[model samples]
Target chain A: MNATLNKPTSSTDVAQNGANRVNYVTPLANILESKDGYVLEAEMPGVNKDGLEVIVENGELTIVGRRAVAENRGREVYRESRAFDYRRAFELDPSIDTTKITAKIDQGVLTLHLPKAEAVKPRKITVG
Target chain B: MSIIRYQFPQVPNWSSSDRLASLRDEVNRLFDFSWPSRDSGLFSGWSPALDVFDDKDNLVVKVELPGLNKDEINISLDKGVLTVSGERKQEHESKEGESFRSERYFGKFHRSVTLPATVDSTKVSASYKDGILTVDLPKAEEAKPKQIAVNVA
Candidate 1:
C-alpha cells in the first residue's frame, strides 16, 4: 500500500544560503485513492491562484505556492505563523496517468486529481 | 502515526531555517503526544495558527484558515481580547475510497489573544483573502504614541 502511494522528494533541493535562501513550510496534505486514481489536497493558507505552480517533470509532481509578504502593519506582539512559502514534490508512479492529471486552487487549498493509467486500472474479466 | 510522510529524515547538512523548522516540528510532536486532548470549552480539537502585528496606528491579526468559507469564521473583540473561532468541515465523506495519508485537520477551532494596547472596538475591521483572515484594530486616541515637549523653567 505504501509503495503505491507517492513520496515527497528531499527538502534539500529548496534550501539555500544568504539572501537567496528561501524558507518554506510543507503544507499539510491528504491523499485519497479510489478505483479511478488518487486525489491530493494541500493546505496553503496564504497562496492565491496566481502564486501557485503545479508542474509534472521527470516523473515528479511538484507544488510550489509563493505567498506575498504582508506589509509591516505594526510591531509583532504575538506570532505563531511565519512568512514562509509552501513547497512539496512527490515522485510520480509509473501506473499513474501523467497527462490526465488536473489541478485547481480554491481559497488556499490546491486539489490535484491524478488518474490511474488505463493499463493499471482494474477491469472485470468474464469467463467465456 | 503510521504515515511515513510525517517523519522528516534527518540529513547531515541543513540550512538554519530548516534546523529551526525541525526543532518546531519536534516541539509540535511533543505537544501532540503529551496533550492528546484537553477538556476545555474555549478550545476545540485544533486551532488555526495566527500572527499578531503591532504597528503605530493599528494592530493586525492574521489567522490561517484554509478551505473555509468566510461565513464559517467568526471574529470578535471584547474587553481588549480578540477572539477568532471557525469550523473546517470535511468537504467529502467517501464511502469507498481509501485514504493513503490524511494530515489536514478538520473541525471547530478557537483562539483568543489579549491586545497589548487599547483599540477602538467600534472601528475594528476584518478581511479574508487566500484563506487568511486579517483583523485590523485601530489604536484608540489615548493609546496612540504622543510626544510631549518639556518646557524649561
Candidate 2:
C-alpha cells in the first residue's frame, strides 16, 4: 500500500505555454513486490517527460505529472471531466534503498523500482 | 468518481491519505462545477469518467482510462447509443505483510452514452492514446449549421 499525497506538483514551476488552464487530479498507483525489491506504478495518462516530477525526501515519495493542455477548437457542449494534471505520493520504508530507486515512464505508466537494502534482501541458507 | 457501496451506506472512515485524495477531487469539482458526477454504483468495480462534446462539424467523446490496454476495450455504436466496455484485471496479490495504503480500483466496467441523432455513425472513428480514448462522430449533413444569405427583405 502506498500513501496518497496531496503535495503540489514540484515541476509546476517549469514554464509552460498555455492560454489559461489549471486542473489537477490524484493519479492512481499500484505497488507490487518482487524478490529483489518493490515496484511502484502510477497511471498518469497525459504527462510527458518534461511535465513529470518524481521526488524522494525524508522517507516520502511524490510523483507529479502535468498534462499538456489541448488547444481550444470551437465549443464544449458537455463535459464529464477534463484530464487534469496528476499528483500522488507514498511513504517509503527504512528497508528500501532510496538511492537505488530507478524510474521509467512508458505509455503513461510510471514504474519506480525500489531496491531492498542490503540487510533486507533474502539470502540462501545451506545445512550440512 | 466516488464509489457508492450500497451495502455500506456510511463508510466515511477516511485515513489521512484517502482524505487528501478525496479533498483534491472535491477541489477539482469545485473549479469545474460539472453536474451529475459518476457516483452511482452502476458497476461494483469502477466507472470510467467520460465526456461528450460537440464542435462545429463533429461530436467527440473522450474517456479517461489509465493503465488499461487497448485490446481489452470494446466500443460499439448501435442506433444512437455508443457503448464502451472494458476490464482492468487485478494483476497482483499480497502474500504477506500488512498493506500500508491502497486506493487503486480495478475490475471490469461498462459505460454508455446516448448520442444525438445528428451524429453520423458511418463516419465514427476512435483512437486511444496516453490512456485516453477519443471517439469522433461526424455530424450528418442535415444536422450541420447552415448559413443563409439574407438580402434586403
Candidate 3:
C-alpha cells in the first residue's frame, strides 16, 4: 500500500466516528479517474455545508459529515434511520495535488476533485 | 431482514403471494439492523435507512436517500399502512478501469410500515431536500391528540 499508484485509488474505505447521541453509517461513494484528476462522489443525506469537514493530514484525505437532528427531538413513534454522523478516509501519494483539491455538495451528494501533480500527469509525445 | 443486493442481476419469474401483501405485517420488523458496529470486509452493502414518527398534528417518515431523483421515489398509503419505495441507480456506467474497492449499493428497495393513527389520505404530502425524503401524514380529526386545559383553584 506504500507504493505510489499510477492511477488514483478509489477510496471505498469508510469510517464512522463515535457519536454522542445516535449511531451512524458510512455513506456510499464512487470514484472515477480522468485525464486531469480523479473525482470522488459520496452520498450524504441530511447534511449541510456547515456539517461537512474535509481534511488532509499525513497524506490522508478524510471526509466527515454531521447532520443535525435537533428538529427530530420530538416524540418518536417509530425510528429506524440512524440519523447520525458520516466519515471516510483515503490515502494519497505524491502524484496528487493536495493544494488544488476542490469539492462540492449538491442534493446531498458530494464530489471531490483531486488533481494530479504536474510532473506525473501524462503528456503528449510528438514525433522527432 | 436480509441483506439487500446492490444490483438487480436477475428478476424472479413469479411471485407466490400478492407482490406487497406480505409487506403488511413484515414492514414493522424490516430494518432492525444492528448499526453502530464496525463493518467487516473491504466493501459493505449500502442501504438507505428510514425513520417514522408522529407528533400532535401529523405523522412523518424520513428516509435517507442521497443521489436519488424525485421521480425515483414512490409512496403509497392503504389500510392504515404506508409504503415508501424507490431505486437508486449506479451513477456511472461500467467503465474499463479496475475497481480498487467497491462498496456502494444500487437497485430497488421498498420500506413499508403500518401507522398507529388513521391518516387523511387526501392531505398527505412529501418533500425531498438535502437527500432526505419527508412524508407528512396529517392525522385525522379523531386521531389527533387533544390538549385539555386544567382548572386550578
Docking class of 1: acceptable
Clashes of 3: 1
lDDT of 3 by residue, B1-153 (tens): 233322221223223353354443334334443456323111233446666777888888888778789999999999998888877787666575434444455677676778878999999999998889989999899988888999998
In candidate 1, stretches whose alpha carbon ends up further than 4 angstroms from where it belongs are: A2-4, A8-20, B1-44
Q: Which ten residues in a row have the lowest lDDT in candidate 2 chain A?
A: A3-12
**Model 3 pairs in collision:** A81-B50
lDDT value, residue B141 of candidate 2: 90
Across A1-128, the per-residue lDDT of candidate 3 in tens digits comes to 43232233322222333653333456666766656667778788888788889998888887888885547534676554554477776776678899999988876888888898898889999999
lDDT of all the models against the reference? 0.79, 0.68, 0.69
* Tens-place lDDT digits, model 1, residues A59-83: 8888999996667676767666656
The best candidate by TM-score is: 1
In angstroms, the error of model 3 at B95 is 1.5
How many angstroms is the interface RMSD of candidate 1?
Answer: 5.8
After superposition, the stretches of candidate 2 with alpha carbons farther than 4 Å from their true spots are A1-23, A124-128, B5-43, B92-99
Q: How accurate is candidate 1 locally (lDDT)?
A: 0.79
Q: Is the docking of candidate 3 incorrect, acceptable, medium or high quality?
A: acceptable
Report the lDDT tens digits of candidate 2 across residue range B1-153. 443312221223223574466457556656664456553233245667666777778888887777778898999988788999888886666775334334566777777777754777779899887677888899889989889998987
